[model samples]
Target: MRLRNCLYHFAPYGFHATWHHLATTHHIPGRIESNPSSLVRALDELETARALMLPRAVAFAAQRRLQKREGRRVPAALHPWDSWGCHDIAYCPDPQKHPAEPLPVVVDRVLGACAAGTDRAGRCLVCGREDWDLWRVCQNCGVASGGRGAHH
Candidate 1:
């Protein structure tokens, strides 16, 4: 169903809005009722992002469990859960600047770009632009990237 592209997952932003944004950015249609199979693009992106997040999530969970056992009330990783489902989440400040690439590829590029120890300093996590402002929104892509660390 067309509504499959519009879902409300347990993410920080409603996944429906995120899906619509991504769909529109990627030139995907809002109504797939005509063919029905066109809905796969949005779902594929979501699934890929989930696949990328799963390992980190599991490790984070294990770390949290260890911390609990160690009597650490707060997560030492700093807002570890704040980024839940942030991959491809609704942070597109400038639709035109959002990459036309897939979500996993964008994430990988951002990871590599930020690997030089620039956690929130140089590039836009989503768009790979070097136009971050005060709140870390990319002037190029308009993504409030939550910083490279959070975005990744």
Candidate 2:
């Protein structure tokens, strides 16, 4: 089968995730087709192509992040074929950028004033407890608060 055909068959996960799954699984070539050796060789060739693209991918992500930081709008690729390129560029690590704040620290700072009753408007939606900690559930009635679907 053509590589493009195989790609179409596995397109639901996107190319990266599909390749990652195949690499991690290490299944035999015969499992995919009649020609066991050729299938393995084809997989290896695809992997090599992917490896060659990594540096460019990383650089592109870093550039996108820098563009976002500078308050400039990102330019769209000229070609429709390239339009669906990486959008999760913030997940990439850049040496020039400061490390992200730890989740616990952020949560603490956000909830600290609320917990201490400094923000009087902040109250538990479930128990209506003004004194409850905002970082966790309502301390009065044990109802979950502050994350996901919880009302502030």
Candidate 3:
């Protein structure tokens, strides 16, 4: 399960590595690499792989969450983070910047902040729109409210 999850998440990287290996090992022609047919075939393979892997990944994630909720211990190998504490999945761009807190907790905090209309709320600089979502994306201009644009 852990292996499947990791493979699903890192499929793109694996594809690239495989492509490089085939190009080098089999002496794949540069002309073939540049060909539209080759590109289409590679992309088609990637899409097919994604279709196959996504369902399994979703199932594993759901099972893990369910196990956690049921007070059952998920196997250490099945954990999102590895033994060395490195993330097995690449969901977050910067895990350190955004710790893996519960979704409900994060949602509640965001909702509360938006409800309170705290310092995070402000006008959108792009179009001077006041309405913004919890993510601070302006409803009026669809731009992010940040820096001097954000107001209390």
Candidate 4:
């Protein structure tokens, strides 16, 4: 019943391999009916990921307000691939290549490379693993058919 209360406050992050990775990594039960509290582990992972950035977001908000006062009404430009909210970050199946950092940081590092222009002229977003089947998972990083890979 307590798990129900916790979940009622949040929406499911949606279905994807990344979601499954979260479930497994966070130790969420393979079957929730047998152990409902394991669901909280999943929620806790989401919360921790989200929490990692709250301070930085708060700082950005304050900086934006200060700029508004200075007649700098324009906001800092975002990278072309960056929308105003969450993006679909990828999960690598191979544990060794999997992103151990926070998802947001991983997104920044991966997409940031693309935004900066790269030496790899023909290669796709994941770099050396070149068979980029657009609208399909990355053969290298397991990124789904969305976000930056959609364009690369």
Predictions in order: lDDT:
0.51, 0.39, 0.37, 0.46
Poorly placed runs, candidate 3 (over 4 Å) = 1-9, 12-16, 21-34, 78-152
- The residue pairs that clash in candidate 4, if any, are none
Q: Is candidate 3 or candidate 4 better by lDDT?
A: 4
**Structure candidate 2, residue pairs in collision:** none
- C-alpha RMSD for every candidate: 4.7, 17.9, 16.3, 6.9
Q: Which stretches of candidate 4 lie over 4 Å from their true place?
A: 1-18, 27-31, 79-139, 142-152
**Candidate 1 Cα errors over 4 Å, as ranges:** 1-7, 10-17, 25-30, 76-90, 93-97, 111-117, 131-134, 147-152
Q: Please, what are the lDDT tens digits per residue for candidate 4 over residues 1-152?
A: 44344333321221343455455666666576876666767666656644543454455567667888999875543322223223333434333344444444554455445546651343444433565643445555555324443444
- Give the per-residue lDDT digits (tens) of candidate 3, residues 1-152: 23234333443223233344223433445676455455444444434544544444566677778999999988754222222121211122221222123222322333234335563445432333465432344444332323111322
| Best candidate (score: lDDT) | 1
Worst 10 residues of 2 by lDDT: 86-95
Highest TM-score: give the candidate number: 1
Residue lDDT tens for model 1, 46-100: 6676566566556767776788899979545433333453333424544444545
lDDT of 1 at 4: 49
Q: What ranges in model 2 sit over 4 Å off?
A: 1-33, 79-152
Clashing pairs in 3: 122-151
